[model samples]
Target chain A: MSNLKGWKEIPIGGVIDKPATSRLYKTGEWRVSRPVIDREVCINCMQCWLYCPDMSIEGSIEGKRMKLGEFKMEYCKGCGVCAAVCPVNAIVMKPESEFIDE
Target chain B: MPVKLTVTGAHAVAQAMRQINPDVVAAYPITPQTPVVEYYATFVADGMVDTILVPVESEHSAMSAVVGAAAAGARTMTATAANGLALMIEIVYIAASYRLPIIMPLVNRALSGPLNIHCDHSDAMLARDSGWIQFFTENHQEAYDFTIIATKLAEKENVLLPAMVNLDGFITSHGVESFEMLDDEVVKEFVGTWNPKYSLLDTENPVTFGPVDLFDYYFEHHRQQEEAMNNAYEELPKVFEEFAKISGRKYDFLDLYKTDDADYIMVVMNSTASTAKYVVDELREEGKKVGLIKPQVFTPFPKKEFQKALNGRKGVVILDRAMSFGKEAPLYSLIKSALYEVPSRPKLGSYIYGLGGRNTSPKMIRQAFEDAFNDNLVADEQRYLGLRE
Candidate 1:
């Protein structure tokens, strides 16, 4: 097996040294628009979690004890499932077009 | 003789594709690259060309479909970038090894993580060793012209290798510029019909491709690939000479600009070379004796031509837009090896700039040129362009 330490030096000769930036600003990229939940309308239901195609939705399945709906944008491919499954219409799928006019 | 219209680099490439009139195209949708296929869809929808456009679910399937189409004696083409090309990796090797002569436009983009979908050469860098003849276009005009030449070069009987034509992701893909598009009849005559000796669908004779090469014949398959790559050195110029006769734009594997008497030079590829050209012009105006060397054909990398351009140059600076994960930037290592063959080589080093859509400005190019002039300064890390800390 090759030593992993020399591998770091390899990219050093190749890697573009990145200037520091706020984590949030650094993460800005062209991403699929996804949905967020309104805590008021969520009733500890897991309908969106069951229907996600990429298994992007992550939340608890506890019965009536935990917060019903919450999803991380990191893994979400913006398939708009949470908004589509919200019984109270609390979830809204804002298309990425709103933020990026392009 | 020339008609000019403003169009995006993707549209320019699509215009060239329509002109060449390939029999089949299998393309997939990916960020920054979706525009190329989208415009081709418009061309097909408008009934401008009679071509089979296969809408594939994934890049792998897209390449597989093109491989099938090309093997059946059809001139086939495809477009993808970054993760899309990564997805097509397995079949890309198969296409080159099989000598199917499929031409693909790689709208180069950064690979994911914190998940970026913008411009970078990460995808192309990862693919350098994949046995395909790669070419990098620095502008919309070359992006359009190279596609026509690529079809002829890849289809040549002596050099039957898949060609990867790379354009900067968001920069060239979406950047609109005026380009001179060749007429359909001219391009059709330039490329001609792709006549392959061994085709899967040939009714006259049946042959098995992608056969199980049980170690005995596997090395021969790779040997054939190597031979084909070497043959590309002659085949590229032949096709380019033919293209120049019709299009009037002569091309070489490596384009030398003002390097005849310069002591120092900067080498680059892709769209960033356009900015480097501007820097070269400004430096020349100040009598600083700077020039830019850009590569039009990457794989079967024009070793002889590259060394000639570096001749008499005291120091050489290679600018690569992509970073190899566990090695020196692909361009740096490749240039180092190329220089090794020369008798009196220049001081060679590299600078990696513009990953993840970072703007590579002319100002940065000037600074890099100035840095290369200093003998005392040994730059440790690759220079980051447009980084605001």
Candidate 2:
């Protein structure tokens, strides 16, 4: 009755449609990969890079700024040697169940 | 009092166990060792020994029962053979680690797998690192003597480690011979009732006996076990001195048989040493300077005593009944390790024989001496003296 939709602040150039925001914005697609990196607690320790039997480490020894060596995902048998030799428990392998295409 | 009768080594062990009157005995009857348990069972059935003899399913269960009974503050005992010992390996480590003071009679036999039932050092060699004090007897008398000594050695409060008295399978376990059995009153006075401030079944004091130890403290527990083993060197003399007073049969780690004024020695263990001593006597009659250094106590191996015995000897030939697959025989390695740093060391030669109960005649043992002396002094073949196959 009293123009309830326009009661809030109205723009001068008619109705401007706003976009919806999502919590999962800008996150990478977690496909079937060998080494999964956690951005929060990753101190960039390269121990996994040193003793990796499959050489399955990715990203640089420094901060997560640049891409360094990538893993040959086909050859990784998931021996957990990288996890064992890790200084900080940052890089963890996602279980095969989590990567199943739903 | 002396019992001059031809009895098997099993009977000898059973008689000693009967006289000692253990509170609990749990044993499994494996071949060459069945006679011991059977004889003891007869004693138990006849009401000779005031004890509970538990008939176990396997050597593993037998050792487990002894450990529990010993933990419950009972004088416990058991016997086993080659494969039986192998099965009880894990619990053997546990029993010694817990310091249960359990005594085990091992009828030394060949470990199987070419399907052999005979005498060999396979069992004793396998258990060299299991933290038990091992004694090897060369004859019926020493076999009887060791059973009594083992009880006294294990029950000492400061040296509460498990002990094993090893007797050769058919040679000692089945062979019949006359020997002296100590008086029951003397043995009773010798092995008094076990009294411990801390025990597993002592309900008055609830304390954890075997707990899960983490790495930080597990090493310390093992170190303590090692300390107890090393403490046996000094404690054994006192225990033996006391035993001497009671039984009047004195013994030492290194039994020097006709070694005085001899320039050469054949070092050995177990029943074969008895035969070698005979050969030494024959050689001495032929004006040879050869003698026998038989180690009565194989574990806590008497390094100083052996060193003194081999001080000025020209050659020291070791006769081993056991064989190491990839390396030298265990006794050979231990002897070499013991004598490596000593000044004026003798020429060392190792001979492997009596495997799977292969007969070792005096002629074969004498051949070992000749082969050792002739084959470039430091021999390495580890020649098998007598074998059917």
Which candidate number would show the highest TM-score if scored against the true structure? 2
Model 2 chain B weakest lDDT span, ten residues long: B211-220
CAPRI class assigned to model 2: incorrect
DockQ of each: 0.01, 0.01
Q: For candidate 2, lDDT tens digit of each residue in B1-389?
A: 75575799999989888977889999888999999999999999999998899998999999999988887778899999999999999999999877778888899999987877799989998999988999999878888888888888888777888999999998889989898887788777787777853565666655555654443245656777777788887788887788788767778888888889876778888888888988998988898877888888888778888777786677878888888898989888888778777888877888888888888899987986775456445645565677645
* Alpha-carbon TM-score of each model against the true structure: 0.77, 0.78
- Give the runs in model 2 whose Cα sits over 4 Å from its true position: A1-102, B379-381, B387-389
Error of 1 at B346 (Å): 1.2
Per-model CA lDDT versus the true structure: 0.79, 0.78
Residue-level lDDT of model 1, residues B62-93, one tens digit each, is 99999888877788999999999999999998
TM-score of chain B of each: 0.96, 0.96
